[model samples]
Target chain A: MFSQRKFYTPYTSPTDPCPPIEVKSYETPPQLYLGFQPPCLPQYASAKEALHRGTLWPALYSPYESPYKRGDTGE
Target chain B: MWYYEKKLQYPVRVRECNPRLAKFLIEQYGGADGELAAALRYLNQRYSIPDKVIGLLTDIGTEEFAHLEMIATMVYKLTKDATPEQMKEAGLGAHYVNHDNALFYENASGTPWTASYIQAKGDPIADIYEDIAAEEKARATYQWIINMSDDPELNDGLKYLREREVVHSQRFREAAEILKEERGKKVFF
Candidate 1:
């Protein structure tokens, strides 16, 4: 499975006052991987789950976890 | 004619009062790429759009209004019991002076919303592209909001709103494809 999250490193100056973040992460929406939505794609087992996730199709669901949280980036 | 639904499309829950977060949430409420701009843009553009995609416009545009209501509920809950000092510290002093605790159509910086935020060229390709871009922008805004928010319950609602943007963008892309396929086809009675 392709990751919806993407990452990058920014140039850090040695003289900078604050510590530079080694890696910065951003998200890519699922639609970028899809050209057009196909018919009869697999759906969530329950409509309530779909409503909670904000998407009925599992393929289109891209979860966003806050990068600020410890270990949220899977580091 | 549209029928009024008494409930929000999605339930909004605010775990606590945080005027600062409310200030940030106002961006989606009335910012350039906010829900209000999105709703009006599609609703107005539908009249000039092609027959096949007009219903899509109507549906998504109407949904944006529901999203707007959700945001309004959040803002109301966040600021309802907040003191003026808290509002000032939250960078909403200007807003407090003008609207008090009532919600106003303004961005986080208190800039009032304007129609200039949206455009309709009357071209199906052009307009649909705009809609897709708008959804992506709103999605990004929601993500940033989640990043700034400390309220887990609020993040739940924000996440849902952000995901809706993804779905809406895909639907618009599919609409574009449908329009493209009809480019040179002729219908005979």
Candidate 2:
């Protein structure tokens, strides 16, 4: 049996990115190599948007235009 | 055109004797549900099977020939240079005392070979299912032999035979699946 389909949000255009971000500093802890680091916070909106556009991080996109034809078209 | 080839799949170089194990392996040759029976069963049944199942039956039947050779080697080695005292120690005194180093064509229990082990009914589905059950039974016999053996060399041979049963079972199952699928697609309307 088929299940209900779920919709995902699309990604935003990378060229339109412009925002001010904050940086936090902390003292180095002992046994830094063995100790675990804080889990990464999720960016819900951006991730949802990227899913919709079929463009996610670590994935590249090609932006170009071509107008060419090949072979016979049953003419 | 003629060709003569002399090559053994398993070269037997050991001279030690283990008549008990040898007697047990003889089942593959002359026992009910033995390799000889299995080979003859599949080969003869091929005629009744659909064209699609012919290759599968042939391949399995050919492998049964290899199993027959393995069993023959085991019997030959077990009986070669077997001393009366050694036979007594291995609990094969009765066979050695009666057969006198000659390999009688018999099962592990010294039962004579019978043709009833093989059948070639003109029904492909029934025959394929029978082949599957036969392979499983052979595998079980191998397991029993392995459990009873202490010699590592003899155990290794039994292990190989056991693994082969698994492969043959799988192939027969695949053949059955193909038959079922083909029948399902038939247009009777």
> How high is each candidate's TM-score?
0.94, 0.64
lDDT of 1 by residue, B62-180 (tens): 99999999999999999999999999998888888889999998888888999999999998999999999999999999988998998999999999999999999989999889889
Interface RMSD of structure candidate 2 (Å): 27.3
Best by TM-score: 1
TM-score of chain B of each: 0.96, 0.86
Top model by DockQ, which number?
Answer: 1
Clashing residue pairs in candidate 1 (N, C-alpha, C atoms within 3 angstroms): none
Residue-level lDDT tens digits of model 2 in A1-75: 211111233454556465422221221111112122224523335765443222232121111111111121211
Clashes of 2: 6
Model 2 CA lDDT for position B35:
87
